[model samples]
Target: MSQPQAGRGTFITFEGIDGSGKSTQARLLAEHLRAQGHDVILTREPGGSPGAEEIRALVLQGDPDRWSAETEILLFTAARRDHLERTINPALAVGKIVVCDRFADSTRMYQGLSRGDLRATVDQLHSLMIGREPDLTVLIDMDPDTGHARAKSRQTAEERFEDFGANLQAQMRAGFLSLAQEFPERFRIIDGARAIDSVATDVAQTVSTHLSSVG
Candidate 1:
């Protein structure tokens, strides 16, 4: 679980089950960093670049079982490849912090363990197509039932995954925790069940500590 080299800029990612407030926290962190005079690019996976966004609609707006697990792995990988090429890489190359809402880890959980025993396939494809990992990953951990309730309240078209119910969400939460253990060097687990600002404070401090350590 060696982290990718720190290159010119830092790459940070937020991970959690749906409605874990990870997206909000990612935005908050980006804004906080920018206010501190850091050059930052706030982006999201499955939709960072034009091409990836198109693929995002296809995968996120369909039936719960719209695509097979194998198909999803391919689609996610393709979108990630496009995102890396068109958005993430260039920003990092120019020494700007890239804060992504989600990354390959999502695919690894959604299409890998949730659907089947495909974690190995996800890793293989990631290694072949998208070789970079985040310099730091902020994982917002939450209770599955609460997260599911929050997600369902959104009423967005991208509720395909949420439709899978809280059971899957529980599985995803466990899977993410396992991933944190697997990649301890880059994963920082934060409690997402608290108040929004409180969680954001923890996230900010976690990232601040990571940046200082890396520098």
Candidate 2:
């Protein structure tokens, strides 16, 4: 089902809808690990690597109309390949624990939920193409509509994905929750409606527990 699909070191991912507080909490997790004197690498999908970042702008800013879902998937996979080869894998090779804000999971939920057909193949490719997954994933689950509002409240200007409808966002949220259910050991879903520190604490604890188990 996966290509090689295995590797050295632990990969940790952060997932959620637009306003799920994943980025902030992912940083907190990385900091917490570093405080424990563990090496931690922080990165993100579709952008962390230089090449990936270039593609990121195209995917995020390019006209969604001119692009087919298949085209979008290929672009994302291309970025992922660049990210893994240039950034993620190298960091892992050095034995550092990586805390990534989004990864293959983002692809699954966003692309899967948006497309009406050929969804399963995209899902299959996501799991199969990537050779590594986070040893733990902290999903900040929230109502996509509320999440969109929250995201808008924070941003000065919205990105392309952020401009989508509540319905699409809801489907994405459903996709994320379904993914969590399928990978019990890999996902730790956290309530994201509370204050930031409260959410951070939950994320920190989950990372702590996963790290302890690994150690």
Candidate 3:
């Protein structure tokens, strides 16, 4: 889909390695913004709208080898397209802030970093199908060991990605940081090892600063 027109709304996405508290932080930021009197919609990738949720199960479940990295990229892009069409675009069109837990970035980190050679393919597919990006991406940065420990504590069918273990998490963390460097204007990297409330406070401040600058 094409990028939203200027002033349509602000799109914010939370991105990080698994267990980096990005999901929780995304939710908290949504609540914080709502309290500030902004209309906000809290959503997630791979499963924001109904059609994409069905795609979510297909990509996230089954064996790790269920799909090749290249195929997985297609699935994620398809899901993202559906999500943008059915949920995100509508929310943004109405001038509501859309806070997403993950976006095309996750596809880049997971498919690109894991598969190594497919990173270029990921970028091309993203440009072809999911060209738009969040106006702000809050990347919660943390050590891989800590992230793995926290991720292991949470049991879910979505353990597929976490199964790659700490080494991959470390690599993905590096990949995420590199992405932040590549997209400095749109990225706000936050130290996620601090207390939850502390991270949330910083996130709020960051969003406030971006909003003010945009206004």
Candidate 4:
């Protein structure tokens, strides 16, 4: 992990293909940071704020082909705008670290790469509408096959995204890795294939190091 300048609230996000345990790790890291006496808010994307959550259901449920890739991107961007204004920005303004399960990066990978070759459009929309990035993005890297197996075990209406299958997961993994390379300063690529505790410990240590540097 690398150091970031202190003096403001930290924004951290966990990203990976579905079933990579990003949600669990996000929760663990939040609890760890809270126990250490830091103000922390753990949230997720496409649905962080109330309005975003409604969008979450709209995007995650229904038929797999409910919305075209471009339209889907719009919905996600709209939800993200709501989330940033109502949830993320407010917490950061109050000097509280925000641990989000997913952020714009997921949109970059899921809609940008996996769903279709819409990376250019995704980037354009992000730059125009949501230009913020996390202070630290912990990417839980793992094999797509493992992620697919794990995702299958937990059935939900959100299966729409998961229906992309293993091939897309592989593409998403590579997309995330590319993001890590592009933003080395704030991206922490963790080996998510390891045991839960091991990965948790590594994530916690990375967060602690960044906090120490910034604090």
Best by TM-score: 1
Residue 81 lDDT, candidate 3, scale 0-100: 85
- List model 1 lDDT by residue over 76-123, tens digit each: 999998888888888888899999999999999999999999999999
Error of 3 at 145 (Å): 0.9
| Segments of candidate 2 deviating more than 4 angstroms | 1-6, 156-158
Taking all chains together, the TM-score of candidate 1 against the true structure is 0.97
lDDT of 4 by residue, 96-141 (tens): 9999999999998888887788989999988777777899999999
Which residue pairs overlap in candidate 2's backbone? 11-134
Give per-residue CA lDDT, model 2, range 65-150, as digits (tens).
64677778888888887788777888777788888899888877777557656568676766666666678888998888898887
Clashing pairs in 4: none
List candidate 4 segments past 4 Å from native: 1-7
| Quality of model 1 by C-alpha lDDT | 0.93
Q: Rate the local accuracy (lDDT) of all candidates.
A: 0.93, 0.80, 0.90, 0.89
Tell me model 3's lDDT, rounded to 2 decimals: 0.90
- State how far residue 80 of model 1 sits from its true place (Å): 0.2
Ranking by TM-score: 1, 3, 4, 2
* Maximum-lDDT candidate: 1
Positional deviation of residue 202's Cα in model 1 after best superposition, in angstroms: 0.7
